[model samples]
Target: MAGSYGAETTQGERYRLSFTVGGLLAPQGRALAEMYLNRMGDGSTERSSQAKVSEKISEKANEKSDKNAGEEVGESIAAIRQQAIEENVLAIRTDSANRRVVAETTRRLSALTVEELAYLAGPDSSTSDREALMWIAMCRYYAIVGEFAGEVLKKHYLTGNTHLDFEDYDRFIADKATWHSELETVSEGTAKKLRSNLFKAMREAHLFDKKSGTVLSFLPSPSLADILRKRADSFGYLPMRESSL
Candidate 1:
């Protein structure tokens, strides 16, 4: 009673269809494989677009951050300069010669090139030069007992040497006394304002740190100092003394 015709006919049809499909698909399959290989060898536009978008986003973010940071630094420098003016006036009243020295120092500092100022402030570092100058100028102004201590520290710092020896600092102070004679006649108010602005500028340039509230020891390089001195001379300020030269 088995239907041999139905089973045999279905098996033969399936075999014929399988052979026909395989023969037809073999070329198509080879073409698809070659297309895949070519695509793998050549990158897609989507990847390039994605990379470009990522780069643009990063650049915009950095620009925004830099703009905001610059504004904050500007405000900080303004505040420090105001304080310097007050302190400079007070210091001058106490000692005229000290006032002269401070004035000369400030004038010299103000004359530095932007690049030189950057180098002085550790621009590559976190702290700004303007902030550092503000703190040092403040220390110079208020800490009458240790007037030139900050400057000496700055010099030592620029030289990549920070010696906290009291004797050495004292010797530096004594040596600076010789330069006092070179001070020009500058008004107390003007001198104070100048010192304040100079230090503020230094902070703005990233030569000093404002957060620790400590003055860093960053001295101008000799070449940079010479450049500053020349600028100062152009501006009618006293030249670098022989000892400093």
Candidate 2:
């Protein structure tokens, strides 16, 4: 059966299902973050303690939009709000693996306002701004993408191929199911959803052309290049135009 993005909802969503920062929420997200920092603060100590960010988001939604805006994401908060933070708030923590990484980078990121990252998620940003957000999102994607899609990205995408089609995805899933007993055939349906959504993300990030399936080149902005340099090992496994940059 032919599949598309979000197609596997029936099978269940994949781990790397979609980019949560949809390029629409930057202003609101930023406002919310600043409010969060004001309400809670953006320091390491503050982030270590959980803030009622969803409560703020709900409040903002009610303030700005029709009352119906409150209806969505009541179930959406706990599951995804962290990814938003990861992509938007603490993005300066580029290659965080554990507590040590977080500790080492706090000097660089701690004083920064949480709302700053929301600009990257906004609509009226530059091409470089868009690329910056995409690159930041990719940084988080590497941390969270499961073994199967991660393997495909490392093995297949890192090679710099220009195109990857559905057949390639099918083969990758079949192979992952073969090697990982925990992810046996029973989960292939779930794996299919994962694969499709992962590609959807790749497309949205401009890593590939969704219409043509052509893997596009990644041109990291100077700032992004600096992050990549600082966090080279973090990105060593993933595909990019140039690693050292």
Candidate 3:
């Protein structure tokens, strides 16, 4: 019986190995059958272990690839956000500089005589024309404030018909009220903030009487134009525009 059993075992191992190898090599279906009851348990255990090992290796490779991809994407997003923040900071700085320049120019131009300002407006310059001219000059003043205030200031005083009476000047000031509405529309909050700062500066300079709602027309005003012009002369800005006075 032992000899018979050994012979059966040998035949069964050969049959099972042949069938498995044939299934891998052949294009036709050579499906496994549980005819080899003696080897069934061991064969099943070996195949399951091989499959689990392959699955673990594939899972680990996929996990590593995903982790690397996530890190790269995170770094890219962080770089873009940092660049945007830097650009916004630069823009804010530029805008703040522009506002300061405008405030300084307006303060200086407000000191000019109405007659001196008339050249900016033409002869028969209506209130609207004068205000438009003043606005233009004020804009130009800010644009060039750091470079050319003094020569421009002298030219303004010298070129205009500076003989208009106070009543005519008062009319010019009254016309400026129309500009308030226009300014409010265009600049909105910015205009109001600038106006407040300007008025405060004027008050401190004694250029206006806040209590009586009156403007003092005769105080020798601090002139940014003159200050800029002097600085420009030291830096050789005299060649740009000859001093008219």
The whole-model lDDT of each prediction reads 0.32, 0.40, 0.28
* Tens digits of lDDT, candidate 2, 115-148: 2232332233455444434434343332334343
Better of 2 and 3 by lDDT: 2
Residue pair clashes in candidate 2: 162-215
lDDT of 3 by residue, 9-83 (tens): 222222111000110110010001110110222323233353453443334334443333212111111222233
- Better candidate by lDDT, 1 or 3: 1
Better of 2 and 3 by TM-score: 2
The candidate maximizing lDDT is 2
lDDT of 1 by residue, 1-245 (tens): 21211111122222101010111111222222222222223423232353453344334334443333222111112222233344553244545543444333333233222223333332232232233333322332222212333355445554555443445544643554455432234445554454444334333444434464333434444544443443332111111133454
TM-score, model 2 to reference: 0.46
Q: RMSD of model 3, in Å? A: 40.6
Clashing pairs in 3: 149-225
